[model samples]
Target chain A: MTLLTIVLLAVITFTTRYLFLHPSLPVKLGPKMVSFLNFSAPAVLTAIWVPIIFVHEGELNVNPLNPFVLSATIAVIISAKTKNIYWTVGVSLAVFVAMKFFL
Target chain B: MLTKKQATIKMIQKGIIDMLPLNLAVIPWGILCGSLAIQRDFTVLEALLMPMIVFAGAAQLVATELIAENAPLLTILFTVFIISSRHFLYGLALRQKLKVLPLKKRVALGFVLTDELFALSTDKKSLKGKLRLTYGVSAGFSFYFSWLFFNIVGIVAGAYLPDLTTLGLDFAIAVTFIALVIPTITSLPVLVAVCVSGVLSVVLKLMGWELDLVIASLVGMYSGYLTLRFTNQNQLNEPEK
Candidate 1:
């Protein structure tokens, strides 16, 4: 089962990973597609984050007092502001631990 | 001095460097997967080899669930097929980007074309044409190797990893997902797509549609795309009036 799982999934992932640009496939996915693909990244980000960043454990845990929430928010802002992913990640870790343990 | 060969080798090295962030995301996932596989009765060798061969987290999860349930082999095969539908889209996307490559290289690249590497490599406008062959292969191999390493780490640690959920490794996927989306949210149609995707996912979950996760994902992507096209056409027609 393990080997089967790995081989099958790897095959699928690899195929699609590079599937976008295959020739002779009638990729009528012209100008709008490029734009749509452009939009997908951030929109998908929102779809994933809003659920967690705004809510937690399936509840609305929106409060500055929530360390996990706070840390993540700070991290997002820092990431956006500085575009420094390393600091954003590091700061978030520190904030999450500090706020969760101490606060 | 073989300087160019060394430079070519750097291609793979560059892949490793770029994938560091991706590797962090892969760790807990690998660990969680490893632990789960063990609980389901996979031998150590089986557990370790799976991630090496398949290397995809979600597909592995779905496959494990099916196996544990003792679903018929056909049912297991179907589930695997459904879970793998994303790769078709992935392949479609890469088709034009890679046609110039010889068949063997394309097939080989296809082998290592996981989600992380594909998303990262395609966006490099600097890597158009056959040049992408080198870059993509390098990146693909790096991610594949990284996955193998961390997966082994996770499988070994799976015995010791208690309440793996508490480790909050999920956030790695969340963070990576967020990072993936940050580049795409520039328009209302796209925003609508995200909302649609989320609402559909939640609704499907509520409706007890166990397999709807990826289905909802496709719903979200294509619907959002059509909506964007519709609105654009409406705007164009409005000018003629």
Candidate 2:
């Protein structure tokens, strides 16, 4: 069953990516649709991250002592300022470890 | 101007070099995904083949998690499809340049069209004709190779290493997403969409919704679309003043 899921996912992913590459299927997405697609990255990524950070064991955990939330907050600030992945990952992991050991 | 052959070679080399930083950044996530696959009880072959076949880091991670939860096959497939829909935009952006290639080459390139490769190859100033094709292929395959290499290492090493889950390394994926999202929150519409989707996802998850991720993503997209439309209308009205 897992194998089948992986294969199906690969097929769908390849198809979506290859859809416009074919000359036979000329797709002309309008400006509105394009703009919507532009937002997909930010929207999807944020949605994915939020649950992981704020939710623990299927419940919301927003306490200040929660290491994940604290590290993520620091990481978000660093990422926004530096726009660099290395610093974001480094600082987040460091903070998470520090909080894990000390707090 | 350089000869065609020289230009093609230079472009390919440039593509490989340009992808280095992102490839480095992807290593930890790839390893994390690999380790998670092992923890999920996936066979060595299954874990190794995933990055090579799926070529999507986040989608693979999500699918692994869903599969481990014993979710139905259809649900897993649908979730991955939704997560990967962003590739459609990448395809759209490269359509004109890629159309000139033969069907076979186009298919091959499409399989490897990742976010980094697309960004590197679609520079309107640097890429043209055969050079564009070569450069994209070079970058795509380089990313593919590095991703597979690190994932394999993780899978193999995961067998010997202590339980990784206790270390909270899984949070790296969330951190990666934060890094990705921070740079993109430039416009009000984008900000609205991100915040709405993010908060809604947590709210729905707390409600015990089975498909909170998918529902949240769709709602977010809709909110962004509406924001864009509203802003455009306002701009048109302001022109009259």
Candidate 3:
């Protein structure tokens, strides 16, 4: 069962990646479609992070004391202020460790 | 004094070297994924196979989370499909550049395509024909190995260390993702898309929607598209104001 799950998931991932990559497919995305697809990165990132940061044990934990919330908030500020990925990840991780230590 | 083979090797080396810096992000992400898989009760063999077979960092992480919750197989498949759907866009974006390659080469390249690889490919000045192929393949291979290696490290570490979740290590994934998304929020439409998607996902999850991520992403994409259209029309209608 685990092997089946892994193989099927790989197939799905490969299919999406190969859908438009095939040389013989003759796929040409319209400008509107391109514009819509352009938002995929931010939209997907937001979708993934929201639950990770906001939810705890199937419940919404929005309090400021939530370590994930506080650390994530600091991560955002550091990310924006530095606009450097290394700093964003580094400083926020430090802040997260500090939060874990104190709270 | 360089032979043709030597020049090819040089280009491939350049590709790997250029990609090394991005490993900063990939390394941690891979380790976290490996550890998370183990924490979620994946056998070490299963954890290792996942990176080799699935080869997607974010999607694999999501899969581990869903598996921990014992979600239905169908739900896991559907959610992974939604998360990986973005790769379709990457393939679309690269179609023209890759069109000249043979079918076999195209398929091989597509198999290893990742967000970082795609970004690296597009961010460069044009390199035609064989050089492009060699460079891209080498870079992809470099990243692939680095990812797999770190997963092994994470698995070993997960085995020996105390539970990492207690140390808040899983939070690294969210931090990495936040770092990735922040630089992309350069315009109003993108900002709107992110905020809308973020809020909607939390709300949907709060409401017990298992597919909240998928739905929120689609809505966010549409909203961003609409915002851009509305902004364009307003500018057209009031060029003098």
Candidate 4:
């Protein structure tokens, strides 16, 4: 079953990727659909990350002192200001480590 | 003859330049995955294969983590399915740009349609017609090689590496999104859409929705869509502005 999971994951991912490559792969998209999918990039991401940040084991981590949360907020501000991934991650991770040490 | 080869090289360089900004974050995530796969008792072969096969850092991370927790196979499958559905939207956005390419090239390109590639390819308007396509292909394949090489690096070091997560690399993924979003977030509408989506995501979580992530995203998307539609209708009612 473990082997099957790995193999199935590989095949399925490759297929989705292949669908993107195959020009004749008729994208079932109409105008309305295209417009809707436009937001999928961010929308889908939000679905995955929000839970990780807010609820851990079904409890809100409202303690504004969590390293990861503080790091992410600082990261967002840095990213918004500079739009650079390297700096944003660098600053956030550094700040997080500092926070861990200090408080 | 020189112009032909030079043009191809130009396209490739443009593709690389476009991708470099995003790759900074992507690289660490790949490294973290490679390192973690080893920590979780994945053999060298499995460590190497996970990124190559799954081809997504986040999904693969989630999948491996779930597998470690003794989750049901069906649950793992469903989780991957949910995460991968993001590709459908990427496909939608690239439709017109890719409409004219032959199937063979499209398939080749599809294998590397990552968020990095998508972000790079979409923002580029320099290469028009045939030249544009060559540019796109170069971008996709460059990412492919980078991914392959990074996975091997991860697999090789899997045994000796400390906790990749403890190293605080996961934050890189979220930072990557912020980096990508900033460029496209120039307009008021786009700003509103992102804030609404992000805030609603937190709100939905507070409301105790188990699938708040998916629901919050849907709320953000719908809000953006309807706002656009309303603005368009109002414009139509008036003369061209």
lDDT of 4 by residue, A30-89 (tens): 776666656666655544554555555555775767876777777778877887767876
Q: List the residue pairs that clash in candidate 2.
A: none
- Tell me, by DockQ, which candidate is best: 3
lDDT of 1 by residue, B180-224 (tens): 554445566776777777676555545556455555666777777
| lDDT (0 to 1) per candidate | 0.63, 0.79, 0.79, 0.69
Task: Give the distance in Å from residue B160's predicted Cα in candidate 2 to where it truly belongs.
Answer: 0.9
Q: Assess the local accuracy of residue B113 in candidate 3 as a C-alpha lDDT between 0 and 100.
A: 83
Cα DockQ of the candidate 4 complex:
0.44
- Ten residues in a row with the worst lDDT in model 3 chain A? A21-30
Top candidate when judged by TM-score against the true structure: 4
Pairs of colliding residues, candidate 3: none
TM-score, model 3, chain B versus true chain B:
0.71
- C-alpha lDDT of candidate 4 relative to the true structure: 0.69
Could you tell which candidate, 2 or 4, scores higher by lDDT?
Answer: 2
lDDT of 2 by residue, B109-199 (tens): 9989876665455335434667766877888889999989989888988877665544655577688778767877888888989989999
Q: Report the TM-score for the A-chain of model 1.
A: 0.73
